[model samples]
Target: MREEHVQDELGRLLAPGRVDATAALELLIRQALAMGASDLTIEPRADRFEATVRRDGVIVPLAEGPRDALPNVVNRVKVLAGLLTYRHDLPQEGRIPADSFGADLDFRAAIYPTSYGDRVAIRIFNPSHKDYELPDLGLDDETRDRLSAAVSRPEGVVLLTGPAGSGKTTTIYALLRHMLRMDAERRARRNIITIEDPVETLLNGVTHTTINEAAGLDFARALRSLLRQDPNVLVVGEIRDHETARAAMAAGLSGHLVISTIHAGSACGVFSRLLEMGIEPYQITGAVTAVLAQRLPRRLCAACGGRGCDSCRSTGFDGRLLLAEFASMSSDLAEGIRAHMRLQDLQAIALRQGMVPLARQGQRAVEASLTTEQEVRRVLADA
Candidate 1:
């Protein structure tokens, strides 16, 4: 059946339009905006398109699409989102808004281009006006206080490391907000530059650049220019290449506080990942200050929340909190890196110097009852 022909005649208590593939697709997203669902998934199979909302770590099936109409539902979403012109063997992104909610969703979409049929996943980005507050990140007081001091430094690289959707970006935004509050008068007079792939958020009072390695407007060049601009603070979305890492060190050495994220499993892994990316151990030692690695787990629902239930959505989870591993640079760890020792060796030294691994952070959350042991094990296992 077509979306226009979808009947809202389902039982009142069963959730309206939930079984109608067409209307449910729209209704589910709209409901996500209404209920503040953080993520949405559309699973297209050989037999049907399974559309579900990820609320409080649970998969709530909103609608089931007929196999024959699977393409239509997927294509409609892409077309409506401005993601793609038509179905093809390529990946794309599309984002459209529902006027009723006045919410803008940023979709990081992909089409597998598989023989099983094109599979699409949509990760929503909800930019809240209040998203930049530090206290609002749901971090524990201990975690918050430690991170707060790291940001207080005058010159050094404060790295934020985590996997995608792990709230690393949120932590960055929150920290920036915290800085703006702490030294608004002083910060107002300083130059702050950022090099992000596709600038996620728009921060006031900062010079932001989008990275384009193909055009030579990459992080290395941007950092060099940002230094010339005499920035007091710097934010780089990702540091994967040697050039960017070198530039980051140069800036930090020249009295700028550099901030960036690396794709590492633990806070300690940040060092190894950097070395793997080709940064010399000495350069890595010279520029680092603190590494704050975190992951976002679902938060519990105060209402309709339970240990386990049909409505709990079968994931045995509710909402999310942060599992963080925070490690600050010390003289001993710096000496290990300077001596060209292995990252594993440096990590052991870091632990000896009071660095907390991210896995420990997750375990603390589990012990606090903020999340389940399974949730902790799922994320911390990588550490």
Candidate 2:
């Protein structure tokens, strides 16, 4: 569609009281997609409703609607997501599979009660967006080779570690696509299953299961039954608790390739996270094949020449690139983990084995002018 056509449609949809509830909901979603937003936050206040959309890891103001027009928008969203519209006293969660925005998009919405009204947060996942390959994820040749080799193994766990919004999901999806491409006929004979809170990307020949906590089906429960289905490859969205971690470890040890994400500051920190989840260090060493930590730094707009320019939306930065650090469980690293070595000692061993640390990757990005030192520091300050 032409840019002018889209702008005209958006203007009509967002004409406040002119549109009904359904039209108002579509207006908000369409506006977000047009702005390339990853998330939308709508909070109801005493006199008005506030909206913000997250773009390129930064939150930008979207709109503030008059109090009268706000509830209709909220109600329309709830109805589409299959949540209880009459109740605003408790937290509610729902998902909507939508295509009105011209792509296959999944909307995960959550409503929570507050003093003023229900606050709604919606996460938008576009499966129709271009799929990425290994190189497209910005992995160096060596790191890519190591990860490819690890995933090629018959059975083991590969964990992608990073804080939220660090592109872990995208990396894992790319890896899965690569694996499927290696031998389509062989893969066709195998059962691949993914258990996610809300399955983001749609993969061919894979069973995607979204977690339903309200229905009493969570990661741990879903995984237990999934094992009976005899899957050759299993993907867990996020290993948040001890139960899910143990289930993933067991599935991996029992000859299923397991992939999952965890919240850790670095690859080495993944071991500590597993241990803190009540998993034994020896168990972690036995099940873990590799851990990859990734971050997304906003790349400087080439058209801007590192100065704020219209092409970059005047943010100085335009797009994003991957900065990754990884560690594999080689014999030495495995033994160290089994022996419960210090984190520093283990990291040193990996470094000697030619593993790149996050700081070095960030510095490389800075030198290449893909981003700035300030951007790197902001993304990796904890690392």
Candidate 3:
């Protein structure tokens, strides 16, 4: 359908009187998927309910409807997610399988109560689309080569650092797939295990497990137990706490090639974050192999030269490209960590040793006309 046609359909579906909440929600999700959105948000206000879709790291308005009809729509989503419909005062989360809508996508639903009404956010995942190999991630040649070399090591922690929704998990999965293919080529069967908060993708021949905090199975506990399973490569979804961070470092030092993601602004920031998590400097120096920091900048629309086009929803962006920097462990870097060197000094060493910053990567993209400078700045403003 054309852009105008989609808007017209949404307008009719979200019309004030006698709305079919279920049908409206279905249309919204279908439209979001068509736009390559990673998330859909439905927020209730005093007089109306607003919907937005996040695509290429930007949130664009979708539609709005009468406040009276929002409850029905929220209830429909709750029904699909199997959330408690009666409890609107508390926060709740649930999952809606693709089978519910007869689509090839999974929806993770979260509801939080506000003074006005309940707010609903849904994350869409297409697990069947597993093309996120290292090459597919759009890493520059040098960064890709560095990352591949880091992951090829037998026993060390290769950490991916980035903010939330920065595609860290996707990159980690790609690395895992790359390793699996390598193992196949060598005809060497190696044990690989992963522990995630929610196992997003189902990978064949790899042990994928999820943390159940309610069942006393958290990341730290899960890592301790998995250590006994003789895993050659361990993938921890994220290190969120002190215990998990300690366990991950220990695993790396104990001869397991550990791969994980952590919330850090840059490759150099990962060390400080780990130190803040109570990890000893010696442990970090001994166990960490590399840190890869990344971001996703919206690519400019080719159809309209970034001026605005119906094809890009008038956002001048059609898709996203990766901006990444890799910092590998070196003898000098290890010594710096052991000596408790400042982050700036450590970063200087990384630069001297041929590490590129994310800003430099973004500049390259801009020069190539792959994305706009404004978009790159927006994505890296915090950095």
| lDDT at position 320, candidate 2 | 85
Tens-place lDDT per residue, model 1, 1-383, is 22122223211112423334345456656655554566767676776556566664445655555556556556656666676646568766544543423455465555556555667666666677238588888766876897888777888888988877677778888888788777785655555677887666777876778877767788788878778776788998888788888888777877899989888888778888777777777777778888888877765444444456444444446557776777787888777766767768977887887766666776676676667667777666566
What is the alpha-carbon RMSD of candidate 3 to the true structure? 1.7
Q: After superposition, how far is residue 9 of candidate 1 from its true place, in Å?
A: 8.3
Residue 307 of model 3 has an lDDT of: 87
Each prediction's TM-score against the native? 0.81, 0.91, 0.96
- Show the lowest summed lDDT stretch of 10 residues, model 3: 1-10
**If both were scored by TM-score, which would come out higher, candidate 1 or candidate 2?**
2
The most accurate candidate by TM-score is 3
Deviation in Å, model 2, residue 257 alpha carbon: 1.0
Model 3 segments more than 4 A misplaced: 1-17, 128-130
Q: Pick the candidate with the highest lDDT.
A: 3
Local distance difference test scores for all models: 0.69, 0.83, 0.87
Query: What's the CA error at residue 70 for candidate 1, in Å?
Result: 2.9
Tell how far residue 286 is off in model 2, in angstroms. 1.2
